[model samples]
Structure formats: C-alpha cells, structure tokens
Target: MTEPAPELVRGELTRELARAAVAARTGVLRVTGEPGGDLHVVHGLVVTVDSPGAPGVRALLARPGRTSTGVADLRVVAMMAAVDGCFAMASGWIGGCHWQDAPEAAGRPEEAMPPVPGVEPGWLLLETERRLGALAHGRVSPHRNHLLLTERGRAMLSGPGSGSRREILLWANGRRSCRDISMLLCRSLYAVTVEVVRMLDDDLLAIAPVTPDPPIPEPVRGIGRSLLPRRRRGASGINDTLPPRPPQPARGQRTLTPRRTERTT
Candidate 1:
C-alpha cells in the first residue's frame, strides 16, 4: 500500500494532535503557582512550578534552550516550550532544570525529556514550526526556516523580531492556497501553516470547511442512472429529470390599504 501523501499525513496528524501539546501544556501551565513559585500537582506528581511575570507571555519564546527560563515569566514560557517541543529545554539555565529534569516519575509515567536523534541546536524550534503546521485545516507539508516566510510568524512575526514586523493579512479576492502563500513569500507550507494556526489560536483567523474538489453535476441524460439498471436504447428507463417548481408572486403584489377611523365629538 502507498503511504499517505505528506500533506495528508500532516492534515491527519493535525486533526489528531493539534490539541495534544496544548492540552498537555494547559494542564501543566494552569497547575503552576505564582512566579515567586508554587507547587503544580499534575497526574499526581508534585512539581515546584512558577508562573511567568513582568513583560508577560511574549518573553516565553524569546529565549529557547532554557533551564530556569533564566528571565521572568518562567511558567508560561515553560508551557510554551512543552507545546513546541524541547526548544527551551535544550540548554542554558532554564533549559537545564525546567525542561531536562522531568520529575523522575515524569514521562512512564515514562521519561519526560527523551533524546532526539539528529537533533541540532535548532531542532525543537523547527519541530515547533511543524506543530504549527499541524494546526491548519488546509493541506500543509513540513519545511525549514532559512526564511520560512517573506516574514516570520509567531516565532518571529510577533516576538523578538517584531522590529521587522510586516502585515500578514491575505486578500479575500485572491484565490490561493497556503502553499501558494508560502511560495509567494519564499516560505514553506508548514511555516505558513504555523502563522495561520497561531492566528486561529489567538482568534486572529477562523477556518471554514473548504471544498477540496468541485463536485461533478449529474450528467444531462444519465442522472441517477446508477441507482437504476441501464436500459436498452429503445426500452423505457427510470426518469431522473427533476421538475421545476412554479414561481411565487413577486413582492408588493398586495399593497397596504389604510383604514379611516371615526372620531367621537
């Protein structure tokens, strides 16, 4: 059997896991205590958790490979890393403990931070890109960030790279798929998918079901023929033509008639 197309694989995975990390993070992020620090009890494990402070959630992705978050806003930042893969857990201060030290009971109840093969300095960041791609309703395939967008997205579009911000609004008049947008801006579909899904995550975009392929209308003379058996050229066959309904009277067919009232002296 042929393997599913990459885009199809992405779409299906998106359908299945789009909420996996978010759900996981939501469970953990919410359990955290104040940034000063509190205990987060998850799946029955006791974790000394701290919420982010100061500049807020934006600081979460600013520094990846975190052990302490090392800055402010460690709680939300840690959750952000959990959802995106291990970007913040790769190194540095926050990366060391928060990410790497998964409660010994953490992940079999397995291990929390397992080794990833062929991982580089940027692997988790890249996987974060893929997770974003998995959030789209449209077909999306994975790719890199050498310049994932003519502009970057949540990763850069609204983060530390905001100085170079650009508009991401797509025109309603233009008929282009996410893939087309990716090509136009010199990005990969997965990258664009990240932007679109983030927009969705933030209520910036909402997706409506799309017609992947146009439907074929019934044939002129063979409509509904499959439901019935084929007839000989001269033999009678099932009549499948639908009759047109009579039109209703146009509006204003009846005009309003004002009634006169008699006044008593």
Candidate 2:
C-alpha cells in the first residue's frame, strides 16, 4: 500500500484527538474545596462515538501505554478507560457532526449529542497533557468541537456562583471583553456581558475605554449653555447674555432673577 498520510502515520490527528478528548475531561476544570476553586462555567460536551467513528476516536486516546495495541484495538482500551472512570463517556454523534456530551444531550433528540462535563480525572487526560501539552498552551477553543474539555476541564467553570456580584467583577477585570472573559471564566457569551455591566454600575468593576472618547459635540455644549435664559444686559457686567439665577432655590422651587446688564450669553 502507498505510504500513509503524514498526519495519520505520525499520529498528528491522533494527537489532536487525544488532546481534545483530554480537554473534554479536563477543560472545564472543576476543583471543588480549594481556595478560589469553583465551577464557573463549562464549554465541554459529552461525546458518543458511533461504532466505527467512536472506535477510531477511542483508539487514539488509548494508543499509548498499551503493549500490544493496534489502531483497531485502541477503542477497546478507551472503553476500558471509560469503564474504569477514565473518560466521562463514550460519545455518539447524533447528527450534523456535533459531538454532544451525555449530560448536555438531554431534551435534544436531533443534532449531535452535546459534549458532557467530567469532574473526575482520567489517565488518558493526564497522558494527553503530558504528551500533548502543546495543545493546551493557548486559550481554550472558540469553536464548538475545538473547545472540548475532559472531567477536569469542566471544573474550571466553577467560579463566582450564579448571579453573584463577584462573578461579574471577575469578568469585568481590567475591562476584559465579554467574549474573552467568558472564555476565561468558562461562561456563555450572554451571561458574561449582562453580569459584567451590572457589576460595573456597582463599582465592583471599572468602565474602561477601548479608545479615547470622541471630542465633545459643540452643539451639545452650546445647548447646555442655552439651557439658562440669556442674561439681560445690566451694570453687573458678567458678560451676561443669560438671566442671573439665585443660589440654592427652595426644594422644588425655581427663582429667575433679572439678568445684570453686564452679563452676556
């Protein structure tokens, strides 16, 4: 047979597969009981591999640490890993190619089974990190499939609790964008944005300008000046073109004093 593709032979794709699978188990990262450790949010999904598809995917995960494992036999090892509580679940792609996790798979009969979260750690995930440390180096994936998290990954989502003011403060740190902060905090796009704004008003977060504020509109300034009536010209000579107003009117009362002749608008 002709030489296998570089990715296939060198296990580049398998490496990606393992990395992703590891992420599915570890990406959401829930380390409960630790200081500053809480499940903030998760992007990982539960996966179900079809007979052939899942077998291939599973095999990739189990390839290493096997003495007599071949490509076909890799799935068997993966099953063992899951059976032994290594993998959270063996995924099944329902449709449209989305690998839905088991927990998220509820209520949706169509579309791929959603990716599921895993709190417990797994050997494959550990191996993946050791072997594919490069993959986890950057920010978590923005795309659906690319962001898969393992059991440990799901735990990373534990942050400030639901509707907690602290959660908003976490997202609004340094005026981080909702999208970026959401990724960091493992929350959804909408949750971060609304919560961040709420915290901002509370002074728990700062309103940061992405760019310099645009120059103040001259007309607006002029309108502000015209809000007061033009002072009648008088000997008071305060460049008056506006009415002279008395200081501190009674509550809910308005006092319109005659404009000094010197006053100009």
Candidate 3:
C-alpha cells in the first residue's frame, strides 16, 4: 500500500479552529509556525494546549515531583494553564495545522494535562479577536507609565467572573504602565501590552499624564471673564420714529432754527 503524505495547509490558527468548531470534530490540532503548539479538542471544545514560553500545569503546580493528590486542584491549574498556553500558541503567524483523532493524553505529564476546564470553540474565537485587537495597538512603547480606569472598567471589575480582565484592572492601578503591570503580574510583556491596548481601544482605559498639570490661576480666569462684555438689557436704543423735519424754504432761500430752548414756569 502506497503511504500518503500529511496534508499541509497554510493559514491562521483562528481559521483552522473555526473550521474544526463548525464541523464539531474531536481531534488534536498540531500547529507549527512562528510559535508552535498543540491543542486538544473534543467535539469542538478545547481540552488542553501546549506551547513554548507558556507555563503549563507542571510549571504552575507547587509540588512538581511530590505526592499525587487533589484532583480538583489539578483541574483548576490545568484549566488556567491550558488557556494561557492556547493564547501563546495562537499568537503570531500559524504555518500549518494537522487534525487527527483525539488522544487519551497529550505528550506531557498527566497532572499537567488533566481533562478538565474544556473551553467552548466560540469563546476561543472571541479570545483570538481580543488578542489581535491588542496586537494592533501594541505599538505602544515599553516606557509608558500611566493608565486611567474608566467608569465602564470600574463597572466590569465590580462584576464577577471577569477573569483576566479583572486581573488587568487590579494591576493597572492608574499608576503603572503596561510594562510595569506585566512585571508586577509576572506575565509576558506582550500579553500585558495586548490587554492594555485593547482596553484603550474599548475606552475602558486611558493614558494618564506623567505629571499633574498646574491649576489655572484665579486671576487668569477673572481676566478671561472680563474679556467678554455684558450685553445690553433694554429694548432697542435708537428711536424708530424720526423727529418732524424743519419746513423747507424756497430753492434759492435759506432757513434758520432757534438754538434756545422754550422755558415754562
């Protein structure tokens, strides 16, 4: 039997994921490109993801080689790690991806690849759009040192289940810039920058001025007010009716009027 070569199609990670989601395929997405990674999906739900430069469950867990316990803890850690890994993997150009039957486990430690916290395909798509939006605005310099929280942002934080959005709000603090926030959060600078930019686009965040501006002097304000003259309050001052005209003389003769005013006792 003649063996067939693996099909290689070049596109974006989001595109491939969209196709898989629409078809409701249960398979492993093997990606190789600028930032390579593997994502496992069952019936269009993302189960796990592995990517370089992103911390997985093993790296996140406190006990790497200790007693195996706490299935619930493992599940939570796995979920966070998987989402982070997927974010890292989906970023940048995607060379190609190969889809195949879903595997029992990925090529990582069982603890790190727990089968919990499956993400909806639609959610993944939304996340990808957010990251791309952030990237478009990531041109912001690393030295930026100011951010202001909007009313909408405050409202969002006040609510529950904002997830990374809440974390970003907490770190923003109106005093730290994107770079500073990233350092404080101990996450990727690019990741933090993306969030910052997206918030800015959505009007949820604003760049704070480095130095507080001086208040306008009271004298200056008064001067400004004085520049404008007050408007007249009464009706039209000019008389609409004209006084009676002096009697006209002949064409060749001249006419004179008395200058003194008439006095009455």
CA-lDDT, candidates in order: 0.34, 0.34, 0.63
RMSD of each: 25.2, 22.9, 19.9
Put down candidate 3 lDDT per residue, 47-103, tens digits, no spaces.
Answer: 777776355566556432445468878776676666666555554445777876765
Candidate 1 lDDT at 102 equals: 30
Segments in model 2 whose C-alpha atoms lie over 4 Å from true places = 1-163, 211-265
* TM-score against native, each model: 0.24, 0.20, 0.42
What global local distance difference test value does model 2 have?
A: 0.34
TM-score of 3: 0.42
Q: Pick the candidate with the highest TM-score.
A: 3
Q: Give stretches of model 3 more than 4 Å off.
A: 1-12, 63-73, 104-114, 140-265
Span of 10 residues, lowest total lDDT, candidate 3 = 1-10
Q: What number of clashing residue pairs does each candidate have, in the order they appear?
A: 14, 71, 0
lDDT of 2 at 262: 86
Candidate 2 lDDT for residue 46: 18
Tell me the tens digit of each residue's lDDT in model 1 across 59-162.
33343353453434455454443432221111101211122223454335335432221122223334644543344343322121122232323344445433
Which candidate, 1 or 3, has the higher lDDT?
Answer: 3
